[model samples]
Target: MNGKFIAIEGLEGAGKTNAIKQVGKILQEQGVHKIVFTREPGGTPLAEALRTLVKYGIDDEVITHEAELLMLYAARVQVLENVIKPAVTQGAWVVTDRYDLSSQAYQGGGRGIDSGLLNTLRDTILGNFYPDLTLYMDVAPSIGLKRVRSRTSGELDRIEVEPLAFFERIRSRYQILAEKDDRIITLDASQELSEVTSALRVQLIKWLKNKGY
Candidate 1:
């Protein structure tokens, strides 16, 4: 219960993975003894399997948008029950790559799913579980997609295969979410990677100090 759950969220090539790595290192240097690093859609074994199905377009014939949403929540349920909750109970700081917000943005905003349904699912399945702080890495959709595509050697996955318009919608949703939620902080990811990392570190330290951690 004493743990702080921090989530890094953005589009595909927003440098969240690198930021998480740097943040963890900084926290370790600061003597944060108990820290847990994990990610959504694949945090646990079950979730990892589901992640493959969801991201890789496996069983595409049977995978509807609603089904995708449900599958994501199912994986999240397992991660929350088995990994995240236990780590938090042990007073471990948790840093996650993505979480519920991804679902809302990708499924609801990009895919045109029902917001009411998403809200309902979130309330019933996730309940009061929410991140203590969320770092929303803001980047242009086209730039993010270009970065991703440049790094990929093979075919794109289902999410990555989405059009630029889809990513634009997702980016817009993220900005809206940040504006609506005080716990979410926005970082301009268009800057150099080092600058973004430094900004994130400063924000995290200030957040920790404010929370009396």
Candidate 2:
């Protein structure tokens, strides 16, 4: 059987990292072996290098929106071929930090890139690789920005440096995607961190049970 792929997605400061960690622990306690946790844009060496360049090197004016979108897929294709597909074929459950939705939200929605182009790239490059389940941690842009500013001590990433309006558009696009996709579970991320984790845990347990885990 193919391994189940679960993806966690949200804006910065939406507690995606913490939630994934907690979910891993919970899965461990449940005696689920072959659980693999990874993140996009950096799951492999090549992807990691691309991630750093995309996040930090804003001076590369050649990295236009189109270039950015293709680069993301390039990394994704590598991850899918080298890590994700192999593990899943080996019956390992995979938890990813982000996936194609980030590309859709950031490049297509936030940057005003054409949705048609994004969809075309996804179809051509990614094909039918869809998450079994996606946990979308939802929060207001203002609150999310405040949390991010308070947590990060270093320079902001290219996406983080975007204007508030950009973030708002991104968040709105996330909401729309979650609403349209039944596989996506939207969670309120504006609540206390502990509370948010608890809710996520509950939802996860329910999903696992339903999946006959």
The top-ranked prediction according to lDDT is: 1
List candidate 2 stretches off by more than 4 Å.
58-62
- What overall lDDT goes with each candidate model? 0.90, 0.89
| Candidate 2, poorest ten consecutive residues by summed lDDT | 56-65
TM-score of each: 0.96, 0.96
What is the C-alpha lDDT profile of model 1 across 1-213, one tens digit per residue? 577788889999999999899878888977886889999898988999999889886653757899889999999998988889889888998999999999999898898998999999999999999999999999999889999999999999888988899999999999999999999999999889989988998988888788786
lDDT of 2 by residue, 28-137 (tens): 87777789888888799999888887787657565677777778888899888889989999999899999999999988789889899899999999899999999999
The TM-score between candidate 2 and the true structure equals 0.96
